[model samples]
Target: MEHAIIIVVILTGLGAVFGLILAYANKKLALEVNPLIHVVEDVLPKGQCGACGFAGCMAYAEAVVTRPEVAPNLCIPGKDPVAKMVAELTGKAAEAVEPRIAQVRCAGSNEKATRGFKYAGVSDCVAANLMFGGDKTCKYGCLGLGTCASNCPFDAISMSEAGLPVIDPEKCTGCGKCETVCPKKVIAMMPLTARVRVNCNSRDKGQVARKACSSACIACTLCVRECPYQAVKVENNLAVVDPSVCVANNCTDAKCLAKCPTKAIRPAVLGIVPGAEDQAAVERACPSCIKTNTAAG
Candidate 1:
């Protein structure tokens, strides 16, 4: 009994000594965090959505405090409002942060796209993509599985009936969360002031694209021809909008909107609601699916 008691006493003494050493070591090795980091962080939204390309608000705050060129206004979700707040806290000028929104480039819905097969697996876009690209015949269309909608922290993206994401600009703070979750990379971030966007992301040839999805851009170059400001450009067999010039163009005559066979070119000013339906019937249902399918064939 005496031996056991002595052993216990020794162990307790050793533990106490180790504890003291650990405390001293921690005090010596601890990182000196700036008091201003907390101040800057307090002003941040703490969404940690990585809109600023930092791991979190704390990371951005660290960079802002330590570095000079790391602008405090890179936070997209925070927008200009947060940028100004951060700048005030860090004693820096707030850079101009143009508000941006997430856009779904794919118009290929179940109604608009021809499916090669039916998906019956994990029911997620990530999983569906592993098994031969996706269920949709179009190699570059949304899987309509709502992975993006599910991952969105602000509930900005919602799945429509025909299998496409509908972005609520009001809810979306341009967090870029939806853009990251999308496996197809069909989503893009454009300036809120942008008045036009190419709704299609397909890089396939015209005939090949038509067989996969009816709404796929055929690379017709009509938009390039119609734009008065020289804003539109045909690249990679797809039309792309130069956001810099596009936001300033007066091309809202509905000319490009009309000439687009697939209605892929939507005016950003009119606040185009990206839908699964065709350009005209996008707001409603297809007036010519059954009868028209028979007539066309």
Candidate 2:
């Protein structure tokens, strides 16, 4: 009985000591929840896709609270309307967030570019990119592994029947996740309001780009020369469109689009070639996506 009493006293003393230490530590370094964090989080889309460069919504919330310029509503998936809402609640400038959309820089759909060989490896594009760079003739073309589609928590992306990822402008949040994950860096964010975009990413010289992909930009500078506003410039063997300088329809002079050897430049709202079927065969790889017409040929 004496031994038992001694053991009980020891246990009680240790518990009391630990309790005091915990209490003191809690008092010294107590962290209270920020009500503004809850406010910020409430305005965000709960996709937690890390498109905003945060691990999750809560992490983004804490960061936004700490840095007001970080824009509580910069979540692309959430859209500009949601951003406006956040700005209103926070009492900050609601400088209209220019809506942005994803653009595929590669033009080598299967029909445009020939496949070197069939890819039978892992289904991920990043994985296929490790072996032989990719299955397409274009060394820098999209791998078409569907990384963009899979990463999109909003289901805004679908691999075209031809294997290229097609982002529904209505569904895309401009979260930049697709841009971040593209191993070939073919995915980019373009302003939603911008009217014209270069649909190609081939940086090769015109003759070389022509051989790799039919639709690859050759940097001929026809578009640059044609733009009355001089909004286009040939840089690094690529014809870059300055959205700030790009004036609608005026970017294409009467002669420029017709001068394109590869027909690579496209009006953002390019009406489908009359009678062009939306049902064109979809490829499993971005580079191997040849039009069904190619199989017919």
Candidate 3:
């Protein structure tokens, strides 16, 4: 018992010595984090969405402070406010970055998309996609099982009763989490200032696509012919919108909306809601007055 006590005492003394050494080493040898990096990180949204090409907000902040070439305006979700704040903290000039928001490319809600079969398996989209490309008749359609919502670090996405994920533009930082998590690649980032979008991702032929979903783009090239500035084109059995072309030409006529037989093209204004009385007028004119009331409704 006496020997054991002595051994315990020696061990206690050694442990105390080692602990002191470690604490001192930690204070002396540890790399001091820059105060500006912390300030920069605090200004960021901490979404970890990888829009800044870094692992997370902290990683981006460190890079911005340490690297001379890393730009301050890389944070897509933070937009101008955060960019300016980060730039001020880092003593750098903030470059203008176009703000963006997540958009559901597919208009195939549960009510719209035809179901091949009831999905009885796991809830994960990636897991569901592995089994015969999910339950939707449109293979490229969203699984609508909340994978994107689940993966989103920010609470910007919610599963709608229509069996589609609805994004809140106000909450959305355009972190691209929903875009990355979507197995069908049906989610995309669009400029926040966008006024028009083709809300379909199906590459199936017109007949097959129309049969699968009422709102599917038939890829009839009507949009291509109607776009005066050639901003809209039918490619890979889908309608793609080129913002640069549209913006450069100041093409606000939106002839593509009227030309789209399936009514696949939609006004993409972020927050505005179109009333029922204006729906028909919007259908005819395709003006900035009508927003994407489909998803919000």
Candidate 4:
């Protein structure tokens, strides 16, 4: 009993001494956390979507608190209200940033697009795309295996019955999570104010594109010729719309939508159809091109 008591006493004394040493080391070695970092983090959406170019919300919070160059309006998911709050927190000017939402660039639905082979591998877009550019004949088309939808922190993306990702504008925080995860690079960050858009991203020639998918952009240059503001261009057998130029000219006319033989050029807003009046203007824009397309059809 005497030996046991002595051992316990010695152990207790050593524990107390070690505790004191640890406390002193902690006080000396602990990194001080800035109070502003917590405040900035609190204001953040906590989505950690990396839209602000940071790894996560906490990282962005630390960066904004420590760095003078970081913009307060970089939080796209937070939008204007959060930007205002961030500006107030950092005592910096909040620049007005136009809102952007994810748009599926490919219109190659299962019904419209031809399949090269069956993809019986992993259900991920990136994984499925490893097998000779996916099952879709259109190499650039979305695999529609829910890789983008699964990665979306905001739950804005959902796979449609047609095997395409449908982004909900209301739920979308513009975080770019879906855009980053898509292996096909079919997802695009489109400005909310964009009036016109090319739904297709196929680089195939007109004939090949039509064979792959009915809605594929043939790079007809009809849109390029029809756009009065010169905001449209055919690059790599694809029609590309310059939203900045169109917005600058206040160009809202859907002239390109009418001229597209494959119905690939469309309004940026989902579910809304362009007016029929634009078709009359397309005939006037390029009569010979329309005549050739009609003859080919």
Candidate 5:
């Protein structure tokens, strides 16, 4: 009994000594985390959207605070307000963040896009895409399974009644969560000041594209010829617009809008509404339209 009691006491003493040693080592070896990291993190939107190219807000905060080379204006969701705050905290030069929004490149709605087969399995886009590239005949078009909408942290994307995702420009911080999640890569981030965009993503030949989706860009090259500033070009069976060139040339006419046979190239200002009829009417009424008509007449 006495030996057992002695053994217990010795073990207890050894455990106490080890605990004290660990405590001392912990105090000595612990890396000091700069309090500024927490301060910077608090200033962040806390979306953890990884728009800043970091894993999360805390990691970005630490990087900006600890790394002198890291730019302070990387947080896209916060826009200028957050950039300025971060720049001030980090004593770094603040570059003006160009405001941007998420744009769904495909105008293929349920009524417009021809369906190859009915998807009955998982509702996810990635899962649906695994089975013969989704139900839509247009392989490059949005799956309309709400994968992008569901993954968007800002609730900026919502599935339209037409089985297409509609992006709310006001709510979209251009964090690119929707863009990242889209299996077809139909979602794209664009400058807020961009005046026009080609809404189609299909690289199929003209006839094949039109067969897949009535609204698809047929690469007619009408937009390329009509663009006075040479901002539009047909590449890979799709019409692409260089907004920077358009802005530099001050080409507000958007003559390409009127020339596009399938209306694939559209005014980017119109939030991602599926129908092109309304957009056509709005484009006709713009000052540029009036001027173009007057000059032609």
Candidate 6:
């Protein structure tokens, strides 16, 4: 009993000494963190979307505060308002952040796209893609499994009734999370001002692409011939639109939209139908086209 008591007292003394030593060492060896980092982080949107090229919001705050070269407008989701705040806080010149939105490049809804077989395995797109490039006949098209919708951090993407993902432009922060998570690479980031887009991703030959998905771009080149500004072209059996050329030429007539045989080229804005008689729909789809038509009339 006496020996046990002595042993306990020795252990207690050793623990007390080690505790004191660790506390002192921690204080002496600790690196002083800049309070400005916390201040910057607090001002951030706290989305942790990595739109700023950092791992998260806190990492971005640290980089922008510590590094002189990191730009204040790197936060894409925050847009101009957040850029202004970040610039004011860091004393950096604020650059305008061009707003962008996520666009699903595929128009292959379940009704339009033919299925190779029924998918019976995992719900994840990555897992499904490993099994014969998913059940879709068009390997490059969306799987309609809600992978992009599930992975989107902003909740801007939702699975439509047609078994395809629909993006809400207002809710999308252009974080590129959906684009990254898409196994088929059908999701992409587009400029918010974009007036038109090619809604197909399949590079299969015209007949094969049509067999797979009725709405697939057949690479017919009709759009190419119809476009007056040389903004559309056929590349790798797929129609590609040069938005820069379209913007520079102010080619808002959307001739490509009218000429696409499969309706592969579509208005960038969702819920707007091309050639619809509704004036509001026409304006929403292509405002500049309406203005030009009105002037001509």
Question: Best candidate, lDDT-wise?
Answer: 5
**Ordered list by TM-score, greatest first:** 5, 6, 3, 1, 4, 2
Off by over 4 Å in 6: 1-11, 271-297
A best-first ranking of the candidates according to their lDDT comes to: 5, 6, 4, 3, 1, 2
Which of the two candidates, 2 or 6, achieves a greater TM-score against the reference? 6
Candidate 2's C-alpha lDDT?
Answer: 0.71
Give the better candidate number (3 or 4) by TM-score. 3
Each prediction's number of clashing residue pairs: 1, 11, 0, 0, 0, 0
| Cα lDDT of model 6 by residue, 214-273, tens digit | 989999999899788888899999988888788888765777765467878877766322
Which lDDT value does model 6 have at 156?
Answer: 87
Could you give candidate 4's per-residue lDDT for residues 188-252 as a string of tens digits?
Answer: 88898887667787888999998999889888798888777888888899999888997798764
Displacement of residue 139 (Cα, Å) in model 1 is: 1.0
Q: What is the lDDT of residue 5 in candidate 2?
A: 100
lDDT tens digits, residue span 1-297, model 1: 999999999999999999999999999999988899888888787777887888988998899977888898987788888889888888889869888889889878778789889889997999999989988888888989999989887888888776788888778888898889889999888887665667788899988888888888999988788666777788889988787775565333434444567667765532233543344442122233334445756
lDDT of 3 by residue, 1-297 (tens): 999999999999999999999999999999978888888888888788898889998999999999989999999988899889888877899989887888888778777789988889988999999999998999998888999989888888888777777888789888888888788998898886665877789999999999999889998998888777878878899999987777777766677776567778877744322111135545545653245344444
Q: Write the per-residue lDDT of candidate 2 for residues 129-224, one digit (tens) a residue.
A: 988988987787877778988988778788764557787877787888888888889888888655456767877888888888888888888877
> Model-by-model lDDT, in order?
0.78, 0.71, 0.82, 0.83, 0.87, 0.83
What would the C-alpha RMSD of candidate 5 be, to one decimal place?
3.3
lDDT of 5 by residue, 1-297 (tens): 999999999999999999999999999999999999999999999888999999999999999999999999999999999999999999999899999999889889988999999999998999999999999999999898899988888888889888888888778999998888888999899897777877889999999999999999998898788777888888899998888898898775678887577878777754556445464554642456656556877
Error of 5 at 182 (Å): 1.0
State model 1's lDDT. 0.78
Q: What is candidate 4's CA lDDT for residue 262?
A: 78
For all predictions, the C-alpha RMSD in Å is 5.2, 7.1, 4.6, 4.7, 3.3, 4.0
Which stretches of model 5 miss by more than 4 angstroms? 1-21, 276-281, 284-297
Candidate 3 C-alpha error for residue 285, in Å: 4.6
TM-score of each: 0.86, 0.77, 0.88, 0.86, 0.89, 0.89
